[model samples]
Target: MSRGSLFQRAPIPEAKFQKTEDVTKERDADGKKRINQYVVGELLGQGTFGRVKLCHDTVTGNRYAMKVFRKQQLMRKKDFQNEGPGRGMSVTTALSKVYNEIEMMESYSCHPRCVNLVEVLEHQDSQKIYVVMTLGEVGSLLTYDECEGTYTAPVPGEWIPASSQSTQCSSRSSTSRGRSLAIPEPIAKCFIKDALEGIAHLHEHGIVHRDIKPDNFFITTQGRVLLGDFTVASKVDEHGRVRGTEGTYSFMPPECCTPTDESQEYSGHDGRAADMWALGVTVWVVLFGSLPFQKANLKELFESIAECQYRIPPDAPVSPEGLHFIQAVLVKDATNRLTAKDALAHPWVSTADFSQLPAYIEAALKVKEERAKKAAEDASVSGSSSFTGILRP
Candidate 1:
């Protein structure tokens, strides 16, 4: 808990639960399925591996999100052969990725901005692993339809120029409806701040959350945003670099799309800077309700990302400060991009009024400032390179 030290891991207890069939069939007087000491209710959400269900502790009546991953599906060879992030991953590697997520969550359980893990349950016979976590009743930022509603078109009289050759590729519609709807400024600031806190926490521990899109950020019923879903997260090397181009294509940085060095299949990149780039894209998505870089074809999409071919619609409702913050983090050269700590000190986030901010946000802001100051002093004394290389006007 001390400043400058990595966040300590809280003990996460593992339990052997009842047989899956019995647990699913046995119902209490309330008509809810019994899952050991917890009563399982409706399904909350699902993913490629398994589904998350709402469950309550019989002893404490406290609600939690039970993430159930099927061991069989996880070990499936086809899944490993998929062309994306999981390509050519071995069975052992896939299973280890799940445990890594649990360990990361357990290690940072005490951090308010990161989701807390209560306990883990394994049913070997049932081929399932159950991870119990604090519930985000309001769901993820993606769950808020209002925040993703259609954007207002530019005024009729406004003279909007045609797209340049760099961005003239065919536009691909997002899977989500109303993908161009922008979240209000105040609300977007709060969400982005929460995300930065989570990112900073991971980076401070020498880890990088390779995947940091909006879907990974969950919102509690209390309106506090907690970052979750670490399936693809990884630890950085001593030099703060990580190998491989892991993450959603649209969120990946320019270097990830087209490696700076083509000699190696997977070149090392600044893990922390890659995270900041993803955060920048997340911010852009939340503020504009549309991807800054989009294309109908996969190759073209990657090309656009590598070229840093994106533009803010002239009618985007973002403020000058917000625009500056986005530009700062989304720099084409990762070396010049803002670090999560530096991002917290950016004018847009730093100058925001804290009176109406959530308690967690206020606390995170204070911690960010303290850490930024310490980092700056450390860099100066050791003549270490600062992540904030040069700010663009």
Candidate 2:
């Protein structure tokens, strides 16, 4: 497909929701809230602007997660102008982002590792929008038991040598939260591989998923990992650039935090490389159960990320290959950072046992390799043409 066609916005047809008294609580005789052909079930999750409800398709006998947005709440100017962490955008921008996410999900629905959008329903009269998507039964990676909570570094004198423990250990020690065990290396490898495959697919299409944290990755009942939540994702231009720094603060790359020109604007950066950095942080959180560079103060956090100053907890259990893989991805230099395909071929990931992984994962890897080969061939042909032009002149 042409790069221009990949991110083209398509208007979603509005579906009229069957009106009922108190739609949130009230149900029909069959004990469900009907919206066209979908039977809206219980509420699955609630957020600032809207809520997600479990829904069933009566005709297809399939289940989906319906995200309902209230137009009034979404249009509130005050919410978008707020100053702090959960900063908002202008009304128009906010609405466009919502639509953009729907467009992206619909455009890439066929990918095996991406959360697919089933349909969108809009209630003009009620001023609401419902987005139906495939359900990720296992929830997000962040909320899962194996990946949640923080890891406390070993006490200064306990893990490190007495001579240098005072400085090194204290710096690594964190009082953030109670400790939790990190995911096992083998299992973490599978999860990271899944994320890499999803990233590879997006990068292949000139799309960058700015948000690549654990919270955005979901797992299904069949044990397949799928990337979801693309509100801040954007397509790079012909020069491979994307403007602004739109992403979760903690997962953003150093370049995103630092302005590029005198105007104080971002001046655009390599969107694909930024994604790899986020994936690096995601991998760190999964294997270590904590962020590699984290601070309560935002300024300090940004400084740490800019300097690439992070230390592996002395007691953290990471193998040599895993450490090497993380180092390659988390490099401060964007140009030197490993791409998704390169990371996948690293010893840490390539050597992992995928014997028990889902069959679809292997299929996806094969597809990624084929696409990479084609991309390299195309680049070679383009280079040859440029050289021929130079000779003719």
Candidate 3:
């Protein structure tokens, strides 16, 4: 296979790239700072390792989401420890978590329903790793729901500070503005169809997305759903099994959570099947505005999932076809759960009326525009903060 042609390989320059005292500060993009290649905008999302910022490609003038991870913060004490003879710690092995995510993103970049990886840049001097991806202007599916103010907290009486509530609500509107409090069946079908295609591709490649949730599914301005966040994704073995139990508590498959004392014939479950269960929950949320097995606590949630006791609430407006689809995938027996390929062929998706979809899509678009307009108005009153200022001090 020819290199660069098959993939836009990130070149490791012979000469080192350096940064000044301020990681975001620039000094005349001469020869030293390529970080200036992309003009960083607002902070999109953040976590323990780094924050993703809305960015613009100077060359193409296209918008993108840039994740900048400070290498200094990523270093763990265990990374420097010696395990055994001839088995000393390696920096590469230590940071395999980040590298594995990069590899998976690159491999699936071309998949229609998978988020595209634009480029990966390393600023050695600043000890920062920058990952540029196709910006989802509308943001994650969860954000879309949040902006619409339709999502009900799983646990009643959940506390949210009033000071940040407006900011949080407004932030979601700026990105993906669709509020799917109760997404129309046709619109939900479209989202599910695209997501299943992506999941099918991942399974075909022996990858299991341990973390499958609405928050990890992004939407483009065009309303296409893109599966993302591969930090916890793992390649399953030939038997389609993986271990370690990592993912959102609400979305985790029963077997992937705390194992019960009852003895079973099987010691582990197929990772791919676990993903299917999560997909069921995601579909339910898209159609109903909340998770099927949501509970006041993690223990109860796990018990609900383990027993497969969730049902489409009587008040929820899900169609029979949609309920059937969720039932097929949320089976207690992992082996019986529908695969992505199987889910794609289900009636709710494969038999969807394309003509009827446009009306729902148009409705969703209208809701998005209305929400965005309101959010902008709110921002003007609150006074928006700059991206650099938020991160610097």
Off by over 4 Å in 2: 1-26, 77-92, 123-126, 144-180, 263-266, 355-393
Clashes within 3 Å, all models in order: 2, 0, 3
Summarize candidate 1's per-residue lDDT along 22-107 as a digit string, tens digits. Answer: 34337888777876788887676766556788888888889988887777667662323222242334334566678788766655
On the 0 to 100 scale, the lDDT of residue 28 in model 2 is 76
Work out the TM-score per prediction.
0.72, 0.71, 0.72
Best model number under TM-score: 3
The pairs that clash in candidate 1 are: 149-181, 179-289
Candidate ranking under lDDT, highest first, comes to 1, 2, 3
Can you write out model 3's per-residue Cα lDDT over 83-157, one digit (the tens) per residue?
Answer: 223344434332566667777775544676877677777645757788777665555665423365344311111
Model 3 TM-score relative to the real fold: 0.72
List the pairs of residues colliding in candidate 2: none
